[model samples]
Target: MSLLGPILLAATLAVPAAFLAACFVPRWRDEALAWQWLAPVPALLAAAAALVAGPFDLSAPALKLSLRLDLPAALLLAVSALLWIAVGAGVLRAPAAPLDRRVAVSWLLTLIGSLGVFVADDLLSFYLVYALVSIPAWGLFAFDPAPETQRAGRVYMAMALLGEAFLLAAFVLLAAGEPHGSLRIPDVVAALPVSPWRDAALALIVAGFGAKMGLVPLNGWMPLAYAATPIPAAAVLSGAGVKAGVIGLVRFLPLGIPLVGWGEALAALGFVTAFYGVLVGVTQPNPKAVLGYSSVSQMGVIAAALGMALAAGDAGAPALVAFYAANHVLVKGALFLAVGAFSARGVRPGLWSLLALALALSLAGLPLTGGFLAKAASKPLFGYGFAALLAAASSAGSALLMLHFSARLPEAWRYEATASPGPLVRFWPAAALGALVLPWLLFPFVGAVGDALSLAKLWDGLWPILLGGLLAYALASAADRLPRIPVGDTIVVGEAAFARMLRVGALFDRLDAAFSRWPAAALALLAIALALAWAAAP
Candidate 1:
């Protein structure tokens, strides 16, 4: 490997690590917070290098660690680094102080982990960075004094830990399955198809990464987290933080070989989650919550595409999914910023509103936008089957949900005319514009630009969005009639179930205490001896 590649790759991590380390010094902490946005520069450069110069790998055998940047990883890393830089600059600017030390610490740590996961090539390293991406982020939202924010943070952390457990177990199985006991991700995944625990590993992998991506039953944290977090934090977490799971799935899944049953099951789950988000999202009053559901819906589409690819053993699915997800990373991030921007003023019929509408519909694959290309790129994976039809249908659903989100933004608008809306809010339009147009630059890696702009392709993208717009219009008149599901729909029920389980555990504790008595213990011992003796006689 060229020295430049290694230096860039190593610095991608080291620079962030250095900033985070400096946060420990009292004097440097403020400066660290002010300059934290710059930490992603190296990562952005590394991503550019990989994309232009091709994939590269770096290893430290003595330390048993490795890093690699493939097309999928590079695509995600570049956009994600952009998100971190843009959002971080707005949130952590010099005047934004006095930023809380904890929030700063959390942001830096989360930034490092978010960028780290894309390059991590080994199972152990991936798991560690994945945890970093998932865990410290609780502070981003939960540091607020609001009761709901605190609750959201707790729920987010619980889900993160649970997901970690699933991933760790799956990784252990993957490592064990490799006859050579290789820790490198590619080696382990190559062996996964024939592993004795293949089914079990795939199941765990789905459950673990699915939790991060906000798949159903586990998706409850997203609405609450996004709704509760500050807009800048929401932008990055929704944009960059969650892609850890996408990279996880892209890296770990044995996508080169078709596992028909598992792939079909995953795709089915994805479609279910997709429509489910739309059905629930339109009823939501909070724009942030609606966007959170939009993410849930969007992630479902990615999962479905991947599942389809997995089912067909299509090796090209990773890059296509990355392209799709890259669009999402920008769009969703900018939409959250838009919420903040729109909220800064009273609702009016003007350019801002028009821009908001454009952004919202873009998620539904409006032509000429990045989303349209993302959807176009994903078509081959589904290949005109029922899954393809469902994919198109999901775009319509996305349109309906996003339209609902745009309509609801006015509810968050401030009546105050005298106050400044702050830098992050001010930066929203540029972010939104970038989100819409930037995918054109990325589409070429996955597909030809000329093909994406063809008349048939344009119509293909338009129809679903039009269908969704019709649904939105129909629903708008009857909006009040739509059922209002709670922000984290299933989470409340899960909490109640957990409470009941705790009560049952208390009862078992009392029973155990009762059984611990000397006489009871002696009787149990005698019974065990008698049983053993009887078995021996047999």
Candidate 2:
């Protein structure tokens, strides 16, 4: 491959890292923040290279950096890069008032990790970038005045750390299982199926990635987290950050290995999450939070596809799955931007509502939309049976949930609309338009256009939406009767998460108090160390 490919790939990573580093320096900080919108340019450029020229590999011996971009990584990176740039614009144009430094730094840190994960080729680099992608986003939500935001931050951090721990163990097991000392992802995964610790590695892999993807039982954090952030932050996180989990599954799971038992179990879980998110989402009153549940449901569909791909031993699963997720990146980002902009003054909530309705239903795989191509491309993987039927139902379920989202949009703007709004509102239309048309350009990468347009295929994509629309209409009147589940439904742990944060804060307090008593602190440290040693002793 040409140096342009490798340079573009390296630049994609280096630009974000360099920019983030610059933000830490006092002199360049605000400028760096303002310029954060420009941060994704290299990534966009790299994606352009990947799209036009195919996959590229880059290695730095001294830095032990190995980055690889194939079709899957390229596709996700391209769409995700597009999202970051688009949303970053909205962030820059947010208001004339000085932007918050914390938000700026947080955005850059998150962007560094977010862009890095797609092309990261080795275990160590992946873990580091994955951590960047998962953590540090707390800054975006942690400082919110609302208790729900703080509570959500607590839960989100807990989940993120928990996922990190599981993934670390999995990576360690994977590395240990590979006798050759190779840390490259492909090499480690190549050793997985026959590794002595195969089951342990796979289990951790699934659980870790599952948490990030917002799979059920672990899904409560998403609504709280997404709803907590400002519009631009929420847009990027939903559209791009969440896809880290999708990429994680793509990277780690060895498709075409016929691990049927595990595959089936994950598929079943995915389907359950799919229905559960929709059921719960409809009850939610907040548009952002409802979209959060839509995320839960949509993510589950992606997971189910991965599961089905695993069961069928389909090597092509990663590309198809990435295509599905890429579509989501654009659509979800655009929708969240729309939600943010709808409340702006002078924007007719009613007219915007109509526009928003069309944008939101794209999640349901509306005909001629990006989501439809995503569904159609991957339909055959599930095949003609119970699995396929569930897949079809998921489209309808998505429709039903999105209709609920549309229904709830007005409620979000109930008291916020007006006749004069800021410049941020202007970007929404462009973002929404991009979400709508961008997928068609990328669709040819995943599947044939003729097949996507075929009468039977169109019908396959069409009926579920019709059924869902009917179902939505049927339920519209009864929405009042639908038991409204609080956003972050069943979030029993937010308090627990908050409690833990409090304890940690208290510990810091005690540490500060004890620091003045140096002798006592030393004794206490020695005692604590001995206690830890005693606990580990055989």
Candidate 3:
């Protein structure tokens, strides 16, 4: 493909996005929702070309916008485009109700950010795209208008704003450290190893991106958000939106150089989160909440792989992580859609349910699935060590969680016996099949597909899944004995914190009210001016 091709692809995202903004006009607002599905087409084209033609870059003078498409990014961009297009269509086709324009606008903005992040070539563009992806999706929760939805939105916004704050600080520190003052990602990352603020920069990057990935204490927003969001919104948010953080880790973290202490620290954290998500997930009754925790767990495993790669100075790790994330993008999106499908009645039980179960198990690395290929491909990074064992255990945990998800399918479907299977069932099989097959085709270009498919590799993928299945069966048989816990375990604790915040806000409000009196305001202004003048004297 020519440079113009990639440029065109990048431009495609903004045009539809721009139209979405224009929707604020009364005349256009309603029509924009119907048109929103087209926004991802350019991204889909760019990703397809990038995969076929190899990587490409484009630049312009006026705005200095740059785009580079490589294997990892292409893999993510392709699948993300697929999910956004499919889900956007599903949303539009669903029974028309009173649609919130604000929700539609937020969706478009999130789509732009989600697509743009995958192709962004420079640090500034990446940051801008990342912000777009994170900040606006709050509207999904906003439109539901329930107390729980409001609370979820509040937590989601808090974490997003916090992440952005950290990213800004990290970006500034990175730019300051660059010897040539270049703001490109490659330039800043090249400078990262020797920079004076390398540790600080890394800290800020991890904290910022970690929040988005839902690592541990930062994870409270995810379950709440996913549980409250509409199905279509949850589909893309879990599948495509969180990939912003994955891409961030790929682009920002210096993988070519060994940073042993930091790498090990990150690895440990990832391991903790992987196990933590499962423990909490199993306790929840809501299937959506379970899937949200599954994402948290799965992303943690990816983080652990990246951490290991960084420690060993493995440049190939990013491609491996991307392949893993790509499988997740499809499988998770399909599973979320499955939630809708399973809720449909009059669907024949045997084939559709079996297919749904198979797709759900794919996340556990069931044999021959894309998840299996992804797991096998990533094995080289874990090598033969404790990390490899941890990886296997995490896969087992995934299997357990997914089995639980499958078992709950019947309960979800029982409510609507007369309802047709809808587009969710019609589109889900394609997405699931795509997730299972596409990685194999891409594996040769990015990694050793033959190695990934080896008999021993197959066994490596198989045993953990078997173990997880057995464990899940045992848990199911003994279900009543398992401890009951609330959805989003620690979120209850967060509610207490929020209550404290209300008290603090009340105090601040009273303070503001007192200061607002004319005499107090004038006195405060005089005090501030006097303090400034005194400080200037030095």
**Two-way lDDT contest, 1 vs 3, winner:** 1
**Model 2 TM-score, 2 decimals:** 0.89
The worst-scoring run of ten residues by lDDT in candidate 2 lies at 415-424
* lDDT ranking, best first: 1, 2, 3
Candidate 2: deviation at residue 185, Å?
Answer: 0.1
Indicate the TM-score of model 3.
Answer: 0.89
Query: What local lDDT does model 1 show for residue 107?
Result: 88
In candidate 2, stretches whose alpha carbon ends up further than 4 angstroms from where it belongs are 93-99, 349-351, 414-421, 493-538
The TM-score leader among the candidates is: 1
Off by over 4 Å in 1: 95-99, 346-349, 414-421, 500-538
Q: On residues 1-538, what C-alpha lDDT tens digit does candidate 3 reach at each position?
A: 6765767566756776676777767676667777777778888888878888878877764797777888889889988988998888866533234555677778888988998888888778888889999999998666666787887888789889999999999999999999997888889999999999999999999999999999887887888888877777888999999999999999999999999888888888888999999888877767788899999998899888888988888888888899889989999998877776666542367987787777877887888888888887777888788999999999999999988888876666543222323666567767667777777776776677677778998898889989998889888888887887666566678788889999999999999898777596788899999999999995
TM-score of each: 0.92, 0.89, 0.89
10 residues in a row with least lDDT, candidate 3: 412-421
lDDT of 2: 0.84
Which digits, one per residue and each the tens of the lDDT, describe model 1 over residues 380-467? 9988879989999999999889888877888765421222238877788888899999999988888999998999999999999899
Question: Each candidate's lDDT (Cα)?
Answer: 0.88, 0.84, 0.83
The better candidate by TM-score, 1 or 2, is: 1
